[model samples]
Target: MTDEIKVPDAGTADKAKLTVAILVVIAGVAGYYVLAGRPAWLRWTPVAGSLALAALVLAFSRYGREFRQFVELARVELRKIVWPNRQETGMTTLVVFIFVVVAGIFFWLLDLGLAWATKLITGQGS
Candidate 1:
């Protein structure tokens, strides 16, 4: 029989990430206290440590492959996104303005017609 080792489960990965997050937060707070007004290198210690912790958490997850795949899919979808060009956007705006103007004219005409009809029926117009 062939033998193959199963990778860590999703729960394990999630737990690892949680633990890493807690450690990062603690480390960041400690670093701030140790070097509150220190130089760039001292300040960067915690910042870089947090980033490294995030990397380790992600790396330790069982769903790491799936997560990476989803990120890749998102990137591909972004590439396929079709942004409207300036000319097309301008044309659409112009069309909307024209439609609004035309609609206003139509409503105004309708209102005037109704008013005239009412006036005629009541003998208000000579």
Candidate 2:
């Protein structure tokens, strides 16, 4: 048995769809600004409409399919994760905070020691 790879041909239609999708998103932003004088409800209509249309267009493209698959896989992986409990999370955060404080103190002391040494070497310290 031979291992064969099948790549989907991105034809003109897919490219057109992707272009239309991008244009729809741009139009949505422009439309939102254009409808600024209108009421809030009316102003948001074109933006929402354009976004939906763009999403629809993209859904038909190869990239969109791959994105959806990735999302699905991510969701599955996330579900499989053994999440830490609230107590464990709190403890981890506390540990990080303590380490940060200790490191800050160490760095501050090192800086002070260096400053003192520099002044002594330059004969500038009283």
Q: Which model scores highest in TM-score?
A: 2
Candidate 2 lDDT at 73 equals: 100
The alpha-carbon lDDT assigned to residue 126 of candidate 1 equals 77
Worst 10-residue stretch by lDDT in candidate 1? 56-65
- Superposition TM-score, candidate 1 onto the true structure: 0.49
RMSD of 2: 3.7
After superposition, the stretches of candidate 1 with alpha carbons farther than 4 Å from their true spots are 1-9, 92-126
lDDT at 59 for candidate 1?
A: 61
TM-score per prediction, in order, is 0.49, 0.72
Candidate 2 lDDT trough over 10 residues, lowest sum: 57-66
For model 2, how many clashes? 0
lDDT of 1 by residue, 9-82 (tens): 55765876767777886787678678877997888788788867766676656555667888999999999999
Error of 2 at 68 (Å): 1.6
What local lDDT does model 1 show for residue 50?
81
